[model samples]
Target chain A: MRHTISVLVENKFGVLSRISGLFSGRGYNIESLSVGETIDPAVSIMTIVTTGEDLVIEQITKQLNKLIDVIKVVDFLEIDHVEREMILVKVAPRKEDKPEVLQLAEIFRGRIVDSGQTTYTIEITGEEKKISAFIDLIKPFGIKEFVRTGKVALAREGTRKGK
Target chain B: MKISGAEILVECLKKEGVKHIFGYPGGVVLNIFDVLYDEKDLQLILTRHEQGAIHAADGYARASGKVGVAIVTSGPGATNTVTGIATASMDSIPLVVFSGQVPTLLIGNDAFQEADIVGITRPCTKHNYLVKDIKDLAQTVREAFYIASTGRPGPVLIDLPKDVTAGMSDFVWPQEVKIRSYNPTYHGNKYMINQAAQMIAHSKKPVIMAGGGVILSGASKELRELAEFAKIPVTMTLMGLGGFPGTHKLSMGMLGMHGTYYANTAVQNSDLLMGIGVRFDDRVTGKTEAFASHAKIMQIDIDPTSIKKNVRVDLPVVGDVKNVLRDLLKTLKEIKEQQWGAVRSAWLKQVERWKEERPLTYRFDKNIIKPEFVVEKIYEVTKGEAIICTEVGQNQMWSAQFFKYDHPRRFLSSGGLGTMGYGFPAAIGAQLACPDKIVIDIAGDGSIQMNIQELATAVINKLPVKVAILNNGYLGMVRQWQELFFKERYSHTHLESGNPDFVKVAEAYGAVGLRATKPEEVEPVLKEALKVKNRPVFMDFVVDWKEKVFPMVPAGAAIDQMIFDEEKEEKKLKAVK
Candidate 1:
């Protein structure tokens, strides 16, 4: 099972390496990780996706909480949460397939971030499943290159148990 | 007041009440050493190597219950402390190591003598800091000590850049350091304590398993009280040797691989197990699924990760062992009379039968010295009052089995990492920590040579630390494995051809050296070594080469399925071979 964990940490240097090093050291692989400053400039939030058994995931969360710089660790597994991943896909489409590609991007609510004589860069932000579906539809048009900002998640208000 | 970063560091150490620092000076740490030259309060002892310095600091921490401090320069000096740092980290020993780094400007330029020590030590250290500015020096030092000594205590490293030490700033020390994210729960949960207490009171066949945390938290008294009140037998891990009285009737000695047969059998047959401050490492658990298979286990530890890490538990209490034990004991006090003599009589009798049937024993030889006999002789001569440290391998196992550790912190060894060269310098640190007490390092022939250079440090400091070298002419533990599991192919395990004379080596460093090649000479050699109170002594005991630690559980086997000595289970040994 994959768990999307949100960790709030002190916005200090080497915090990323400390976290990443911890994951690697424990033989836990990060499927996706994204970090950015939160509302408080001194704090940063990291959303990490990792796969493990329930027992291992519990250990992972506990170990994450053990690091001094880490402020909070929340596994979005049980809470009602919102997750989004953004990907910029550059595609080279033949003239006949250009209409189909534009229609597919429109259906996915993607915007053409950039355009070239031979390629189009479309930006899409959505749940992982939606992004994967969009990429699958766009694959027929010949993807030239792509970059993704891994998943970032936030728990919905009042969804947490007992609150 | 304004002061240089080096002076601020010194002031911080003084504030922390540090009496001695085990360190090795190098190019990058010259500024700090120069500042210390005129310092009056803090004494700096230069060791032969960085590894020795760190291990000595670890031993001091284990003995004194204070955060051990070590300082070394960058590159090779910093790298050399890796093994020692890992050893301390694995054992949950509190240590703060200061490694000198190149100037901040050259940190990433790969300058001469520069190493990214903070990055290198990230996976091992509980936390680390690379001080980029002088302003953060004092605060960083304070936080490093705080983090190193709190919660599940472990080693913390502060990489000090040369320029940072030279930079000047206000020497303001933080009165208190607090990390919002780092609060440790000293008290266990109320409901969990109640549940645990209820289970303990109702259990008829309960066994208490203690580990290093009991010793670390100084909870041995509480542990003993609980065991006695509940009529529970106690079994200790290697690190937990001194957490309970080894000679107590209820004490089942150590459990798991190389553990006493009675202790392992008790655990396997147990109906309830209260694991206090234990992590259930594989060496203790054998096959996790089969370990304590018939028992309901309740694990208590300060580190939450340690709970259910290797084996699932029926109840988990995450808190300091001392605090949790206090609560559990209080809760149990509510139960009237609290004595289990009648309820647990049958179980205790069965355990006693096992102990009598297969007590820990090694065959005696009149012509040649046996390592176990040597350990026994040392115990008798010292009257079990000396603090014992050990190098890894057969010597360590023998020491654990024979020498009874009756108090917490009396036995300090590399239990977690099992580092080979840890004992000698560790003994030096333990001796320095308690000047009036005796310290001994039970060492193997192969392990003593690892940090043998520390003899000079011991001699220079006039620490009367004793080193008992069990010279078995081979890496006895590995040889035993090869002999039993791999068809007796000695391969490279033999060391007799290149072995140096340890007595001469000790004498060369101005320390007393004695060699006992015969069984009858062991007692005299130990007594002669004990008479030297001003200088370190090394007693090289030439022992039987083929003797192996018994009650051995092969890797992946159940704890109860153990192979004993040839005299007791010759058929089992032959079957495994």
Candidate 2:
């Protein structure tokens, strides 16, 4: 089973390691992870999606909670949450296909970040599945390059205080 | 102060307290080396081969428990360091390898000295980086160090394009890095620790199997205390050898392919096996299906991938060995010495009997110097105190069998990758890290030639490394296999045609060289070699050609199905007379 854990850690040197060391040292697998500083100056939020049994997740949570810099750990699976991911896709756009490419971009609510004579960069943000579906739709146009920010998540209202 | 990425790299290295870097210079790396030249406190030892430089760095990392640092040029230089980087990755040694790539504009253009170093090394390294911008250089250097030295330590590579290194940028060292995917667990769960303690407390014939992680985690003391407290006997993997005092009564010596008979037997019969910081490699468990069949296994490791990779576990504790052991000790009650006495006596008796029956011995007359005899003599002289680093092939196994390592980190070798040329450079690093201890590299004739260029580095640095080569005139390990299983076709195993005189090679490199053709000369030459304080020495021992490591259970064969030496078999026949 995969569990998404949201952690608020002190933004400091070696804190990234303290968290990852817990996984590698204990033999846990983090399938997908994304971390970034929140609006707060001193706090960083890390969303980690890992696969393990209930016991393993409990152990991971307990260990993460013990780090001096870590303020909290919440398993998103147990709570209502909103997950978002951003993806950038650069596709080769033929002169004849420019209108069609723009039409599809407008349908997906994506923005053309850059344009060249032969290519255009499309930026989209949504749930992972939605972005993946959009990339699949654009695959026929020939994707020159693609980059995705591995999913970052936050718990929905009522879940934070309940935990 | 504002500085170039190249200078910031040096500054970050200074902050990390790095005193030495082993590498060579080339076009792309010149700017970094140029700035490094101005840094008075940092010392750079240029190696003839990039592979040697990386291995030396890895050796330093293993010995010091700090991240070993190396720098090299792009393309061939970066590719050359792959084997060493892979070796460190497999063994989980902490290392930071920096390579210079072509400038940003020249990338992907088939430019001079260009290679996709980051892409090539991504699979091998724990993490890798390609500095596209100069502004990220300081933070990248800092994160590279932080990642390399932390949790299940392994090699990390930073590929800096020449433009980035030379580009101007205001250096701002990031106070923190936000890498979410790389979180590592450190503390042991109180619940799991208590559960583990309960398992240990109730087990009747429990054994502690310590691996190299004990050394990495610096948990040797805690491990010893746990073993002593629980009255559990300790056995070690090849990588784990020296983690426990070999002379300790509770120590079961090494367990594996060349492991002691008693240790294997105990593992076979034990009721519970407590594996700590071990990966349970195939060598340690002869035939996995049959390995510890009678025992319930409790595995403790920091890497989760290793837990079910080889052996199944009834109780798995995923945390640092030191922390987990500390918590377990706190929760568990001390075991009575009397409770362990009966089991210890029986096991000891069995070990003593095995030792008496097949004492590690080989007959070596003045005419033909046996490799086993030479190894035994080296052990006799060192009293197992000196750190022994070995190259791959027959000599490596011989050293494992002959030398009795009682403590951790004393027996260093490339076990996971089994890289042949690892010994000499690794010894250089180990010697530098532990200056007070004597370090020896036991290498084979074929394995030594791979990285023999390190002779220059050793001589120039005045590293007191004693290189003992078991020259069998053949790739002894492969030759043995061909002789045993391949009907002795002997196609490419011979090294008689183009082999360099190692003594002459060492001498040419400004190191003392000794050739021991007879058994009588082995001990005296070894003693003299060890006496050298500042100079490095290489001793080439002309060992017997037909001699092979005995008690060999062929790969995939059952544990008990071991091939004894023919002479020993004949001796058994005569004993019947």
Candidate 3:
């Protein structure tokens, strides 16, 4: 099962690599990972999306806690959570189909970031399902380029998981 | 005054009260060694290999109940410590290993002698660090020692970059460590303790299984008190051999795969089984579903993850064994002792019947020496006074089975990792830790050859560690498995051709050498080896190659389903009566 996990760790050198090494070395599957500085600059919060059963998940969490730099680990499955992913797609636009593509972008609340004579670069941010729905509608127009920031998550306030 | 990272490293070690370091010097760590030239307080024992150094530290940790320390250089030096790290990890021995790394600027550039040690050791180490800056060095060291010695003690590593060691920074000693997420619960939950005490007070058939945690927590006194107070029979895991007195009437000896038949059978029939500090590894549990089938199992452990990870724990209490056992005793006092009377006596009589039915037995031939007989002789010669370390496989089991360990920290071995060539160097460290005690390594021919190079370290340092090599002409454990389960193919397990003349090898290292080929010669050889006060003596005994460890339980077999030599089993039972 795919679950999002948040790990708070000290902002020290090589901690990221160590965490990633743990996953790869132990044969745990990693779907997506995103890390950034937290409210305290001396620490960082990382959001990881992974798939595993109860035993595997328990092992991963316990082992991560054993790491000195790791401050806390929380699985979003046990609490209420919000997840987001962002994507950028460059779609080929025909002279006649340009209006339809613009209307589709407006309906999804996506912005056209860059444009050329034959291509329109559209940017969108939402939950994974919404981003996938937007992609499904635009793929027929010939996607020239595609990129995405992997899923990041936040647990709702007053859950397992907040100070 | 400004201090370099190297000076800070040594100073912090001194502050930690570390008296000895076991390691080998190399390219990246040369700068750190250069600063050691003027040091007079700490002694550095140079080992032949990085693996040897780490195993020595592990031995020191086990023998002294202190955090063992080691330092090694980068690349191959760091990689060689992996086996030792995993060994210490498996057994929960406290150790701190420091490895020299390439300079910070050259780390990822593939510079000379560079490796991502932190990446390699992530899975094995309890915690590890790579210091990219000089300022974080001191606090990191302090944290490493703290994490290594506290709460299910295990190994921790610090990767020191060359540039960081050469760079200067003002050192600030970390005062109090307050890790918000890393707190270990010392006292168990009061509710759980009361529940356990109530069960113990009412149990008609109760057994206590003690483990390595008893020794690691220094809770031997508490464990003994609880056992005697409740009139309970106690059995120990391989790692927990010395945690409870082996000579006590209530002691059931080692339990599990090669465990005594009485211990295994009693556990299977018990009504209340209390497992203290045991993880219930597959070897211990055998067939998990059938293990303790008649019992309600309770567990006390510091690691919450360990409780019920494999076995179904009925009453799980998360706390250090010492504190939990202490709390249980106190709560047990609150409840009035029950009058089990005939019920408890009948259970004890049944357990005694099991012991008399199948005692640990082996008949030695006058013409040929048996490894079991040799181990028994070593025990008699030492009068159960020597510190016993062992190599893996048949030798280790025989040592665990025959030689009784009555005190905590008296028996040390590579229990978890089962590393070959661990016994000799670890014996060196054990000798260094307890200078007055006699240290002996019970070894197999194939295993002793793995680290025989350490003989120089023993001779030069005048460490009088003894080696008792049981020469069975093959990797006896694997060979025994093949004979029993694989139709006796014996494929590649033979080591007779590559085996060395161990007696001569010991003499060449400026140590005494002795050999025993007949059963009558075992006692004399061991006595001679024990008397060598200033130097090590390696004793090689040629035993029957086809002999195997008895009372065997194949993998996945239930704990009670042990297979013994059919004829010997009947004869031994009759002989005992």
Candidate 4:
């Protein structure tokens, strides 16, 4: 099962390595991982999506929590959460099909970021499934280039959990 | 403190408590070497080949349980270290390999001595870094050390572009790193510990299959304790040799391809196999489908991926072997000494019977030298006290079968990678680590040629390493296979005509060289080699070319289906007589 874990760690050097060292040493698969400082400069939040069984995930969380800089680890799957993904896609659209593509983009609440004679750049933000569906619907138009920020999530309202 | 990347590299070494580094100089790494020259606290050993430097680093890591460090140049220098890096990666040794790269501006242009070292080493290293900015050098070096030494330790490469090495920055080493994706678990859960204890208590005929992890985790005592407490017999893989005392009644020598008959039989018949620190490589388990089919397996390994990579495990405990064994020892009830004694005695009797029936002995003629005799004599003289490092081929197997290694980390060899030139440099590393103890490298004629350049390193350092070269005048192992299954049509196995006089070569390298042509000369030459206190000695023994390691289970063959010595066509007449 794929799980997204949100970890709040002290902003320090070598900490990124200590965590990755753990995964590589244990031979665990980290499908997508991204880390950056939060609004609080002292702390950095890392969202890691990995695939493993329950025991593995639990063990990963425990080990992560034991790190000197790690303050917390939250498995978003177990908690009520708001998940979102943003995708920027460029499609080579024919001149005649531009109207249909624009109409479809409007229905999906996508914005036209850039347009060329034969290409249209579209930006969409929504839940992972919505973005995936939007990409699937636009596939017939021929995607020239695309990039998606693999799902970033946060705890739902009124459930402020802290490690 | 304000520092350059080169200075930061040395400072990181200081932080890691490194006293010695093995490396060579080149265009790109000149700055780092210059800085190292001024660093009085750090000792550097210059090697002739980059491969030798890396292998020495590997040996150092294996011997000391510290991250072995090596520095090489760009392109060919970096490429030369690939084999050593791959060998370390395969064996899971902790190493930090630093290679210089072309400057940032000239990187894509394929400048002089330029190579994409990071890309080349990515698959071989646990992790790697191509330092583009000088500011990140200190952090990268620290991270490299941290990654290389932690958890399931393996080599990590740092490719520093020449511009980065020469670039100056405010270098402050980071105390900690914040990588969320990499976290290795060292401690086992209490519930799992209790469950493992229950499994051990329930198993009537249990056996412990230990591997290199025991040595890596420093769990030999714990492993022995667990085996004694549960009254379980122990069998080790090639890498696991010396983890359990070979003289111990419960120690069932080595198990797998060339393993003892009793060890293989014990593993086949056991009701439960408690594998601790072993990956269950193919050489250990001949046919994966039928291997330990009747036994309930309990696998304990630091790397979680290794648990189900081979044999299926009924109970998988993923944690450091030492920590897991420590917890299990605390929870489990010790077996009664009397009961354990009876079980050990019975197993020992069976092993003795097998040994008597199929003793590892070879006939020695007055005219011809035999490799088996040389190994046996070495064992007799050393009393199995010295660490035996072996090169690949016939000599490696003979040493594995004959040399009785009763302690962990004492039988250091390239088991996983099977690198040819590993023996000499590894022996050098082992000797450096344990200067007081004896270190021997049993190498083949072909294998020694691969890294014979290290004789200079050994001679210059006065390492007192005793190298016993089994000269069969051919690629003995491959020739044996061809003789057995390929109608004796030797393709490229011959090495008799065109070869350097090893004795003269050793002398040229400032080491004593002894040649043994007759069987009787083997023991005396080895004794003479051992007596060379400060200078290294290489004894070349011309052994029989037709000799083959027996009890052979051909590749992809089942354990039970093995070809004993007497079954060989030439040996059949001797058996009849």
Candidate 5:
């Protein structure tokens, strides 16, 4: 099973390495990780996606919470939550396929962030499943370069449990 | 109060109530060392190696229940602390390690003696910092100590750059350090505590598995009370050796790989297992699938993750060990008339039979001194009063099996990392914690050589820490493996030809050296070593090199399916050869 864990930690030096190092030490690999300062500037939020069994995921969350710098760990699966992911994809469309690509972008509610003679960089921000579906459609147009921000989530009512 | 970062660092250490620091100086830490030259209240003990300093600090923390402090230089100096940091983290020993880094401006550049100490130590340390600004130095130091010593205590690193130490800053001591996201649950769920009490009140076969957390939380008394009141047998992990009285009749002795047969059986047959402060490590649980199969386990620990990390439990009580035990005792008060001890008589009788049927034993042929015999004699000589530390491998097992601990914090070993050279330096650190108490390092020839240079540190400090070397002439544990599993292909396990005379080496380091080659010499050597005060003594005992530890559980085997003798295996190997 894949678990998306939102880890809020003190925005101190080497904290990212600490979080990532913990995973590596435990022999767990992070599928995707996106880090940025949270609403509290003193703290940083790390949205990490990792695949593991129920037990392994539990250990990961518990160990993350054990870290002194870490403020809170929220697993999206535990409660009603909203998950969002963003991706910027540069698609090299053939002259004939350009119209199809634009129509697909419009259908997905994506924007053309950049445009060149042969490539159009499209940006999409939505739920994780929607972005994945959008990428599947864009891949047919020949994706030249693509990158994504891993899923970040918030509980529906900011409810806390098992603290 | 304006002061340099170096001065602020020293001041913060003083404010943290640090009386002693175990460290070594280097180029990157010159500024800090320069400031230390004038500090009168703080005592600095220079160790031969950075690893030794860290181990010593670890030992100090384990013994005194205070956060140990270690300071090392940058690059190689910081690199050397990696093993010690891991060892401390695994054991949950509180430690604050200060590593000197290159100036902030040249941190990423390949400057002279510069290393990313914070990056290197990130995983091993509970938390780490690479302070670039002088203003953050004071608060960082305070936070380092606070985080290291609190909750599930572990090592924390603070990387100090040379320029930051030289820079000026206002030295303001933070009155209280707080982390918004870090709050430890001190009380276990009350409903669960009552349920556990009710379960224990009815359990026909009950057991208590205690670990180092009992010692860390100073809950040994509470644990003993709970076990006695509930009439449950007690077993311990390697790190939990002294958490309960090994000499007590209800004590099942150490459990798991090198554990007593009776202890393992009791756990397998247990109806209710109240695990106090133990992580249920692989060594203790053996095959987790088959471990305590009949028991409805209730795990009590401060670290929530430890509860189900290795094995699942029926009930989970998350809190500090002392607090949980105290609450448990109170919950059990209502069932005082039940007399749980009277109900579990039959189970206790069964355990006693198991203890008598297959006790830990060794035969002394008199032709050669057995390693187990040496440990047995050391125990007799010490009267179980000494704080015993051990280097990893066979000697460690022998000590755990032969020398019983009847008090808390009396037995120390690198349970998690199993660092080979941990014992000697750790002994010195333990000695420093209890100046009037006798401290000894039970060692093997192979592991002792790992940090033999610490003899200089021990001698100069005049710590009467004794080192009892079980000189088996081979990496006995590895040799045993090759003989049993690989048809006696010794490989590089033999250290006979290249080995130096241990006594002579000890003498060279300005320490008292003694050798006991015969079985009768064991008692005399131990007595003489004990007599020498303010001077460390190294006693080397030449034991049967081929003698292997018994009651061994083969790799990947269930704990219950242990091989009790070596003769059968050796005979089988001979047929193959």
Candidate 6:
């Protein structure tokens, strides 16, 4: 099963490397990871997408908590949570297919973040399935470049019981 | 007062109550060594190799229950300590290692003697730091010590750049360390403790499997009390050898791949197995599905990650071993009547029968010396009072099986990493930690030579550490495996042609040298070596190379399925008994 885990850690040097090193060292597969400073500048929140069995996921969370820099780890699987992933896709389309691409992007609620003479860089943000659907619809027009901002997650306020 | 970073480091050490530092000086660490030159309180014992220095520090920590300190230069010097650090980390020994780095400017520029030590040690260390600024030096040292010594203790490394040491800063000792992200739970949950106590109360054939955590937590007293009060027979992992009195009737000696037959049987047939301070290492739990299959497993550990990492744990109480054990005992006492009286007695009797039937024994040869005999002699001569360290392989197994460790920290070895050269330097450190106690290293011929240069360190310091080399002329453990499973090919395990005369080597280093070539001579050599009071003594005992440790559980096999030594299986179990 895939788990989206949010870890709050001390915003210090090498904290990212430490977390990544931990995952690699323990042979845990990390599908994607993204980090950014939280409201408190001294702390940072990292979202990691990893797949493992229930036992492995438990170990992963426990191990993360063991690190000195890590403050908290919340796995979205246990409680009500929301997750989003953003992807930017640059598509090169024939002049005749431009209208169809624009219509598909509008239908999926995507925006054109950048434009080139023959390319349209569309930005899409949603759950994994929505992003995948947008990419599939845009693949008809050659995708020149692509990038994704992994997944970011947060637990629902009322559903979070205890640390 | 304004002082150099090196000076601040020294002050931090002084404040931390560190008296001895096991280290080797090199290029970048010279500033720190310079500070130690005129220092009066802290003594720096220079070792020949960085690995030796780190292992010595580890031994000191294990013996003293304090954070062991080691310092080395960057690049090769820092890299050499990796094995030692990993050894400590795996066994949860508390150690703080300082490795000097190239100047901060040269850190990632690939300058001379520069290495990203913090990055290299990240996976192995409990925590590590790279002091990029002088202002962080003292605080980093304080944090390093704090992290290394607290809950589920392990080695922590502080990589100090040369420029940081040379940089000037005002030194202020931190009175207390508070890391927002790190707070260890000291007390077990009341409900979980109650559940565990109930399980113990209801258990019929209960066995307590203790590990290094017991010793690390200083919980031996509480563990013994719990076992005795509950009438639970105890089996110890290799690292847990001394956590309980080895001579006690309820004690089932070291359990694992080379564990005693009765320990394995009791664990398999157990109705309840309470794992106190143990991680249920793979060696201890061969074929996890079959291990303690009949029992409801309960694990008490300080590290939450260790509880269910391997086997299925029915009840887990995450807290300090000492604290949890005390709570469990208190809760057990609250019960109105104990229903385990007759059932527990019968269980113990059955375990006793298994012990008597298949005791740990090696065939006694009157003419040819057996390595096991050498360990027995060391145990007898020391009267079980010496601090015993061991090199990896057959010598270590024999030492664990024959010698009785009656107290925590009495027996120290590389249980997790199984480093070959660990014992000699560790013995040196153990001797320094417990200056009045006799410290001995039961080593193999293959392993003692790995760090034999430390003989000079011992001779210079006047540490009378005895090194008993079980000279089997082969890497006996590897040879045994090859013989049993690999068709007796004996590929590269033999060490006869390249081996040095250890006695001569000892003499060259200004230490006493003794040799025993026959079975009758073993005790005499050991006795003579024990008489040496001013320098280390190397006692080389030529033993039967063909002897193998048994009853052995082959890899992936259930613990109950053991292959005993053909020569000793049916014999009367009178040898080590």
Question: What is chain B's TM-score across the candidates, in the order shown?
Answer: 0.98, 0.95, 0.98, 0.95, 0.97, 0.98
Residue pairs in candidate 1 whose N, alpha carbon or C atoms collide under 3 angstroms:
none
iRMS of every model, one decimal?
A: 0.7, 9.8, 2.4, 8.5, 1.3, 0.5
Q: How much is the lDDT of residue A56 in candidate 5? A: 92
Q: Which 10-residue span in candidate 3 chain B carries the lowest summed lDDT?
A: B336-345
Predicted candidate 5 versus true structure: per-residue lDDT over B1-577, tens digit per residue = 6788888899899998998899999998998899899889988899999999999999998888899999999999999999999999999999999999998888899999887777777778888888878888888898888788888889999999899998987888888888777788989998989998888887899989999899999998998998887788999988989899999988988889888888888888889888889999988888888889888998999999898988988999999999999998888987667866679899999999999977888777687899999989888888889899999989999999999899988898999999999999999899999899999999999999999999999999999999999998899899999998999999999997888999999999889999998888889999999999988999999999988887887776778888777665576589889
Candidate 2 positional error at B531, Å: 3.0
Model 3: how far residue B205 lies from native, Å: 3.0
Which scores higher on TM-score, 2 or 5?
A: 5
Q: What's the DockQ for every one of the candidates?
A: 0.87, 0.06, 0.44, 0.10, 0.78, 0.93
Error of 2 at B218 (Å): 0.9
Those runs of model 4 whose alpha carbons end farther than 4 Å from true positions after fitting are: A1-163, B1-5, B38-40, B132-135, B163-182, B334-367, B567-577
Reproduced native contacts, each prediction: 0.86, 0.00, 0.43, 0.00, 0.96, 0.96
Q: Write the per-residue lDDT of candidate 2 for residues B288-403, one digit (tens) a residue.
A: 88888888898898876667667778888888999999888878854333455554556556655765666555666668998999888998998878889999989988988788
Where does the lowest 10-residue lDDT sum fall in candidate 5 chain B?
B563-572
Q: Name the better of 2 and 3 by lDDT.
A: 3
> Which scores better on lDDT, 1 or 5?
1
Clashes by residue pair, model 6:
none
- List residue ranges in candidate 6 displaced over 4 A: A160-163, B570-577
TM-score of chain B of 5: 0.97
Off by over 4 Å in 2: A1-163, B176-178, B334-338, B342-359, B364-366
**Docking class for candidate 1:** high
User: Deviation in angstroms for B526 in model 1?
Assistant: 0.6
Model 2, range A54-163, lDDT digits (tens) per residue? 76787688667645468888888777889988888999967788889888888889999998879999999998788978988889888999988777887787755444
Q: Residue by residue across A1-163, what tens digits does model 5's lDDT show?
A: 8888998898986678778888998999999999999787998999999999998999999989887778889887767778888899999999999999999999988999999989999989999789989988888889999998888887887665543
TM-score of each: 0.98, 0.80, 0.94, 0.83, 0.96, 0.98
